[model samples]
Target: MVNPLDHPLFARVSHYINLINFLVLVPTGFLIHFPYTGAPINLVRNLHFIFMYSFLINGFVRFYWSLFSKHKDLVSGFLWNKHDLKTFWPQIKYYLFIGKQPNNPNKYNPLQKTAYLSFPVLALLQAATGFILYKPEKFGGVVSALGGMSAVRGMHYLIMIIFLAIISVHVYLVFTEATEMFWLMFFGKTEHKKGI
Candidate 1:
C-alpha cells in the first residue's frame, strides 16, 4: 500500500513556507524590540516591518491552504474537537515515553491538531498588537482599548517568546522522530511508521 503522504503538495509545502517566514520574522522582530546599537535602529525597524509584512502575507497563504487546498483529506484537520482534547493525555504520555503513540490516527494526533491550530491565533494576536504598538497615535483607540501601550507591548513580547519556546520543542520533537518525518516535511513522503 502507498503512503498517504506521498503527494508533493501535501503538508510539506505550507510548512516549509511557514518555517521560513517565522525564521526570518522572529529574529528581526526580537532585534527591533530589544535592539542592539550595532546597526542603526531605523534599519532594524525597517527590517522588522518588512518581515512583519511577509509574515502576514504568509499567514494569508496558510489560511487559504487550510480552507481550500485540493488535498481535502484533512483540510481542517488541525481544528480541534472534543475527542482531541480528551485523548490528549495519552499523546502527552507517548511523547514523554510513558505510553504508546495514538492508534494511528488519519494524519495528526489529537495533541498535534490542537497545537498546530494555535499558531494562527497567536499570529493574529501578534499582528494586532504589533500594529497598535507600531503607531500608538494612529491606533490610539486600539492602544487605549488594550489598556495602553504597555499592555500592547507586553502581549507582543509575550507571544514572541512563547512561540520561540514552542518552536524549540517542536524542532526537538521532529528530529527525535524517524528520518522519514524530516523527509515528510521536505518531500512529502513519510515511509509510514508501521502502526503510526
Candidate 2:
C-alpha cells in the first residue's frame, strides 16, 4: 500500500491550513496579551474574537472529518502507542544529531505523535482561557473556577507562547527535512514509488 504522506496534495493542504491559522491567529492573540489603549485596541479585540471563533469552528470541523471520514487512519496514527513511547528517546537522539535516523518510519515520528497529542490539549487550554477572558461576566463561572480573570489571562498568554514555540519547531522541521513534502501540502501531489 502507498503511504498517505507520499500524496503531495494532502501534505500541501495540511501545510496551507496550518500556515493560515498561524498567520491569522498568532498576531491578534499576541496583541490581546497586552492591555488595550485606544480605538485600535477595539479593532484588534474584534479581530481577535473573530479569529478565535473561526479557529474553534475550523478545529471542530477538522476533528469531525478526521474521525468519520475516509482518512480516519491518519488521525489514529497520531494517537499515542507503547511503540511510540519506546522509540521516543531514539527519535530525540536522531533529531539531536546523535543518531542518523529513527528506528521506525511510521506515518509520523515519535516526536510528531507527541506534538500532535499536545496540540489539542494546548488548544483547549487556550480556548478555555480565551473564552473566560473574553467575557468575564458571561463566563464568570469558568473565570472563577480558573481563579479569576487575572489567572485565566495569565494562562492564556502562556499557552500562546507555547503554541508559537511549537509552530516554530514544526515549521523548521518541515522545511529542513522535506521541502518537497511541505510543497505537497499546498499543491496536493506526491511522487510515485514502486511497491516496498
Candidate 3:
C-alpha cells in the first residue's frame, strides 16, 4: 500500500516562505526595537515591513489552502476535543522521552495542533502592534486602546519572544522526534518509516 502525502507541494512551499520571511523579520524587527551604531534604521524598518507583508501573505495562502485542499481534514483536526485531551499526556510524555509515540491518526499530535493553530493569532497581534508602532499618528486610537504606545511596543516585543520560543521547540522536536519529516517538509519527498 502506498503511504499518503503528509504535506502537499503547496503546503511545503508556503511553509518555507513563512520560515524565510520569519527568519528575516525577526532580526530586522529586533534591530528596529533596539538600534545601535549607524544602524541605518530607515533601511531596517523598510526591510521589516517588506518581510512582514510577505509573512502575512504566505500565512493567508496556507489558510486558504488548508480550507480547500484535499488535506482539509487537517484543519478540522486543528481544534481540541475529547480525543485530543485523552492523547495529550501521552504526546507530552513521548516528547519528554518517557513514553512511546502516541498513535495519532492525524498528521499532527495534540501539542502540534495547538501550537500550529496559534501562529495565525500571534502573527496578527504582532502585525497589529507593529503597525501601531510604525505609524503612531495614524493608529493613535489603536495605541490608546491598547493602553498607549508603550504597551503596544511591549506587546510587539513580547510576541517576538513567544515566536522565538515556539520556533525553538518546533525545531527541536523536528530534529529529535521525526527528523525525516523536516526533510519531507523541505524537499517535498523523503524515504521514511510509515508513522514518522
Highest lDDT against the true fold, candidate: 3
Per-residue lDDT value at 164 in model 2: 85
lDDT by residue for model 3 (1-196), tens: 1133767778788888988998899999889878999999999999999999999998887887788877765457687777788899999998888999878876678998989999999999999888888889998777888899899989998999999999999999888877777768876556465554
lDDT of each: 0.73, 0.70, 0.84
lDDT of 2 at 194: 46
Measured against the true structure, the TM-scores of the candidates, in listed sequence, are 0.82, 0.82, 0.88
lDDT of 2 by residue, 14-100 (tens): 446656776877787767666566637777878877767766666666566567766664455677677788888888888898987
In model 2, the worst 10-residue window by lDDT is 187-196
Q: Candidate 1 residues 63-168, lDDT tens each?
A: 7766776754335466666667767898899988999877745466776666667787898899888888877889988788888888988999899888888788
Model 3 earns a TM-score of 0.88
Error of 3 at 128 (Å): 0.5
Candidate 2 has an lDDT of 0.70
The C-alpha local distance difference test score for the whole of candidate 3 amounts to 0.84
Stretches of candidate 2 off by over 4 Å are: 1-15, 35-39, 190-196
* Model 2: per-residue Cα lDDT at residue 55: 65
Give per-residue lDDT, candidate 1, residue 110. 76
